[model samples]
Target: MEYFELNDGNKMPAVGFGTYKLTDPEETPNTVDAAISAGYRLIDTARVYTNEALVGKGIKQNGIPRDQLFVTSKVWISDNGYDKTKQAIDSSLEKLQLDYLDLYLIHQPYGDNYGSWRAMEEAQAAGKIKSLGVSNFPDYQITDLAQFNKVKPAINQIEINPWNQEKATVDYLKSYGIQPEAWAPFAQGYDHIFTNPTLSQIAESHGKGVGQVMLRWLFQRGIVSIAKSAKPARIKENVDVFDFNLSDDEMKQISELDRKEGVSADHTDPKTVLRLSKYTTNLNGLD
Candidate 1:
């Protein structure tokens, strides 16, 4: 349950419970409830996830005080203009059954992001969104937006795992006082991540699983991470990373695992950008 102070002087949990693919309408609420019960204070959801209402139900069911819980949602690429992004925020609040969000992010960089960022700035000033950030934004996008925006991005959510460490991007964002948040912190268990000898050896030494080692490495590197799991046991295990430390040698061994490429989609591709722009499915159904 470690925390990091954002550039705006707010505290964000270093480890968060991610709700990326918790699509089952029934499973979403149950899993979110389990995560909250397992000591998760940060709940990350997105409009594209289409499970905000379920996540809200879980929070309401848990009965955790609103101020004690940190809820985050994002503005989808389809809702990219200033007016649309602002409307999207209110829609998210209504769906999540909350008055304000702890954090709100521009879900992608390929949009009228400058316009969207302006809306986010207005929302923060109006107190509807406490903090602001972006997801899948590379180094240049942050610089381009931050240079002219009223409020700089507080964080950048990107895919960060051993195979795609994004060290350079993280360092660049840090220089602008932006915190780097790891989305797929375990590479989604691709390439036999759990059975990797280097990670397994380190996990063995610490009596932890490979997932725990990956999360610990992110924490030690000062990156915020979100790990997703529908099972309560695995959800609990993701948070049990603070009990041990990774030695410098062990850390280096893990650091050397970076391939500096995304395990999933490539946001840098123009085709990806064009594809996202056409993805106007109206995830929130507010349009």
Candidate 2:
């Protein structure tokens, strides 16, 4: 697996396993173990996912050295504040059964993000979190946060897929020196992404699947990506993207397929802010 060096000088795995909806107590751990067995060292979860304990169990089951694995979790919207975020950090460490997290992020841009960032900074200074970042934050929001905060954000994870290329945002992020991480790299197979003609043609040319092509495209752009899957075969397939390379023309063809839209919620919408703020979870309990 390849690694990306963050602004803080921490090396993060380029392709990470995303546990967004992998909530089954019995199944999540096994899948996570399988992913680890398939050479995935980066595992991303969130307090909102309500499966940190299970993910923790999987980490133990794999028996890999703690330092060799990169575990990440997030502070949910409800936990956004200096006090709540500090507590949330400890709660996550307890649930994940880890001494410290390799990375911790603000799940959303809403709430008292400044307060949350301050808490994150403290956690890093205290050695509870190795690196701090934000998710679903636009370029402007990230810029403001980075400029004012003592510690610049190491990463900004946002939607980037064939339909939502986010070219301008990505360019700005790179220029600003914040590593761009891609969430929903496959768009959750939206709009029949796996069967799209352009992607299929590109896959055929490279003797790879559309998923691999997409991941390779992101890799070529120097973007870290998170891919989620419950099936072991799919989990193994997602990480097998380092074998091939996409040419400049193929990359351009894929770029042409961008629609500048995403399948996920709009972070800028007021309704989104309202909904996420009210979406509370019991981090102490597993789902």
Candidate 3:
């Protein structure tokens, strides 16, 4: 349950539950309920996730006070531009059954991200969004956005794991006082993440699973991490990382496991951007 202070003077949980593909419509609510009960205060969702309403339902069903929870959602690539992003924000609020979001992000760097950022700035000024940021944005893109806007991005959500540490990009963002958040922190199990021998040994030393060790590694590095799991036991394990710490040598061992570029799309590529912009999510039932 460790927390980090954003430049805007707000606290964000260092570890969060990410609802990326929890798309059962029905399963989403129950999974969210399990996460909250397991001591998760941060719930990350996106319009593309198609589970915002279910997340809201879970929050209400859990009966946790709104003030005690940290809710985050994102504007989708298809919903770019100032006007569309503004409407998307209201739609996200309605779907989440909340008045305001703890954090809101532009889901990608494509489309009218400049416009999308402007709309998020207005939303923040209006108190509808406490913190504004971008997910999957490269360092230069973040800088480009920050140059013209008065409110710099408070965070940058990126793919960060043992395989893809993103140190250069992360350091660049930190120079601008932007906190780095790790999505798919486990590398989605790619490259035999959970079964890695080094991580396994580290986990054994801490009496924790490899997943916990991975999160502990990120925590020690001062990065916020969101690990996704539908099982209540896994959810509990993800949040249980606060009890132990990874030694510098152990951390370096994990760092040595780095393969450099694994388990992420090349978002900077025009082909990828075009493909992502073409994909549309169906929020029909959830809405």
The top-ranked prediction according to TM-score is: 2
TM match of model 2 to true structure: 0.97
Cα lDDT over the full model 2: 0.92
Candidate 2: residue 217 lDDT (0-100)? 96
- TM-score of every candidate: 0.97, 0.97, 0.97
Give candidate 1 regions above 4 Å deviation.
Answer: 281-287
lDDT (Cα, tens digit) per residue for candidate 1, span 1-287? 78999999999998999998787888888899899999899999988788889999999988999988889999888889899998999999999999999999988888799889888888889889999999888788888898887888899999999999988888888888999999989898889998999999999989899999999999999999999999888999999999999999998998899887777778888988776777663444211
Off by over 4 Å in 2: 283-287
lDDT of 3: 0.88
What range of 10 consecutive residues in model 2 has the weakest lDDT sum?
A: 278-287
TM-score of 3: 0.97
Give the TM-score (vs. native) of candidate 1.
Answer: 0.97
Q: What RMSD does each model have against the real structure? A: 2.1, 1.9, 2.1
Write the residue-wise lDDT of candidate 2 on 200-278 in tens digits: 9999998988899999999999999999999888899899999998999999999999999999889999988886777
**lDDT of model 2 at residue 58?**
93
